[model samples]
Target: MSAYKSADQYRDIAGRLALPSQAFIDGEWSAAAAGKVFENLDPARGTPLGLIASCDGSDVDRAVAAARRVFEAGDWSRAAPEERKAVLLRLADLVSAHAEELAVLESLDSGKTIKDCLNEIGHEVPTFFRWYAELIDKSFGKVAPTAQNIVGMIVREPIGVVGLVLPWNFPLLMAAWKLAPALAAGCSAVLKPAEQTPLSALKLAELAMQAGLPAGVLNVVPGFGETAGQAIGRHMDIDAVSFTGSTEVGAYFLKYASESNLKPVGLEMGGKSPMIVLDDAAIDDTLVSSAISAAFWNGGQNCSANMRQIVHTKVKDAFLDAVVDKAKALVVGDPLDPATDLGSMVSEEHRARVLSYIEIGKAEGASLLAGGGASAGLDGAYVDPTVFDNVDPAMRIAREEIFGPVLGVIGVNSAEEALAIARDSDYGLHATVFTQDLDKAFHLAKRLPCGTVAVNGFSEGNVTTPFGGYKRSGSLSRDNGTEAMDQYLQTKTIWITLK
Candidate 1:
């Protein structure tokens, strides 16, 4: 009760939350053009937390038009770097100021733990704004040496009026991931938060306005993917789009782009990432803990979650025992409780999806090592942290991206075999390798075929490193680091002749 208090307190906030009820367009709170509203449910209790404006294509049109006007007006799209930097920094401070309010809001909205909400909204969200703010002036143009008579310059300019499509898993944090970089690069944006969890994003827009962002510079229209998402993708006025979601939906954006404006589309899609442990690696507490954390963190809803554990034969048995022991001890309870290690699934539909995959794993002949029975009496969308052993690479459980707290263990005879198994995936988003030998670590990392590889532990890198994927997992456009700016910018070369 110390950390997040009782269920009564959570219900108290949930019942009377000052949740936003409208779309943000042209820096004002506006309802959907159709005036439709959707039931925003708290996945923890499967109750209606509130109602949010259910926008559609018409709202997208209004938001996009607003973004276009601001871009053309140069109020934000052409603002000086330091000026943009100052505004973003102020927004970051505001996010920090309203941290607790946002944490509880998101925890209720998404069924994510309040602790996770705090870490994301209070820490990661603001860090992104500050990082991009600091990067604003530091992002330099290039000068190319030419013949003495000529001066050649290369520069990056904002790709006017971009559309940003967000995901539900880490709602506010993902918004910051795209928005901070886009704004820092001096682009006007039309943001669409996932309809299921739009509260924090709406709050963020409010804070941005308070931070002195001009009208029409940042607009957030929350809605279903079919209407608002398609509109943003197919909108003629938008110059580019950045998305984080499934591979299936990611392709639709490309289709929308091809059918309409042929806009540049950037995608950070799904993954069935692997955590590899070689025989030479220590089967100690650290290794065991890393294995569990990689697979179960955030209830394994992460895109880069290392849910596929590919371990060498020699250490497989010991590792499995340690993993099972630790997995059994995880507490699944109220998301608001700070002591809770695992929280509720985002929705009943998603919980069913994860449970279906568990049954599929059994039918496909993998052993249910732990979990998949019943979540300890805490109701709603709660799902147990599940693990499967003897998972073959060909099993559906190993190949598919089960976006839940499901972990599958596959054994290999040698390092080569482990590496081979890890690389065999339609996705190449992230991979982890644990090896005592330095040479072996580098060998696996170089050949993993993923965008980001961790040698000793599980990580997607900090804000400074680029994160995307190889193959179908992502586009050439990355989401973090200086590379994120590339998705929202266009290059220009200027040539001059000396007199």
Candidate 2:
């Protein structure tokens, strides 16, 4: 019924794309220093996509040296803002020109639905480039008022030689979130994409060169976290490191920075975000659909995913019925199929981890309201859209970040109870509330201890709004919007005495 092509058609397109398999450094694709490689598998079918360069600390050092050289040479770092903006705009245009190829590569490499890869990430990636491109020329330094005999000015300057470490969930989009703003701030960068999903990032590096980005201005080294990632975190030459992944890994980055150069580190880490549905929420199909989409979008691999659903007791039965029914109706199949709503996890290991959590939920005594196992007749890393009801706030399934298509529903007696339950988490990344009363909506919005909150909506902040987290969910640095450029820039105050 869907207009999407078959599995064979996707294979043909993927072959035509012929995504690069080597690490992108300086300005060329090259083999690893040790000539080592790692296999990338299609999670949808467990088939080998290709081999990516298995870079290690030596490769990271080379890439960082290249970035530092470019930064010190003042090729990109000293370029005029307007010129940098023009080049970034050109890169955005090229991204649009090769949208389909990038989307296919993302879906194939990350095991996300092709439809989402095309519609969500495909569109968002270029928009981020364009957004930062426009900001580059408009953002300016400030002149501070001073004493009559003195002139003071505050100028924002790019921090040299940034290291960007990306996550696998939204490979290209997350890369854009870091790369766009860093480049706009006139910083040279060495990026490390996740080992599980390296194809799209490599392709992006190639496209950057095509857009006239100078050699070493932007480089990507793909490999395991212990090697390439740790090197970036611990590198003395890198002025700052921007990372997006789990809290455990984020803490490690902090340690790496502390033990090395004490460089600035920005992290957007894990979450167990809550979706609160009040008793007075409009009991409509739209509300049910929005709640479902919030928890399962991108197969719930999002760090801001609303894995916890706290519903008021008055409408608990109705909400649970609708949510469970919708979860059951979701079609889990090959990611290439347009009709499939839920696709496989990023890898077999992740699938097993999610399944183990399901068993843990059962052992911990949460009621299995909907799906609780793998999809029938599929051998890939597919897991059904799972829902667990009668979940306690202290349950492992409710408190932890599943990072999968698993939703836990907890019933609350009042608005006070819902707020208390939502705030009882180490992560303060994202949360949402569904209600008709403006008083209740605004009240919850102000009290919820998260970086982002939506009333009667499901989306996180957009390109115009700042996106990050509170507590352990993120660092002081924020991403997106005009403020994101601040992460890669430092302020210097200059004063001159009048003659």
Off by over 4 Å in 1: 1-16, 374-376
TM-score of each: 0.97, 0.98
- Where does candidate 2 stray beyond 4 Å? 1-8
Model 1: residue 416 alpha-carbon error in angstroms: 0.4
The sequence of per-residue lDDT tens digits that candidate 2 reaches over residues 386-476 is: 9999999999999888899999989999999999999999999999999999999999999999899988988887888889999989998
Taking all chains together, the TM-score of candidate 2 against the true structure is: 0.98
The digit string of per-residue lDDT tens for model 1 on 1-499 reads 1245565676576567698989999989998999898899888888887788988999999998999888899999888889999999999999999988888899988888877888888889999999999999998899998999998999999999999999999999999999999999989999999988999999999999999999999999988999889999999999999999999999999999999989999999999999999989998888888888888888888999999999888998999999998998998888887777888888988988998999999999999989985486777898898889999999999999999988899999999998889989999999999998999999889999999999888888989999999988999999999999999889999999989
Model 2 whole-model lDDT (C-alpha atoms): 0.91
- C-alpha RMSD of each candidate structure in angstroms: 1.7, 1.5
Best by TM-score: 2
Q: What does the lDDT read for residue 153 in candidate 1?
A: 99
Q: Following a full C-alpha superposition, what root-mean-square deviation does model 2 have from the true structure? A: 1.5
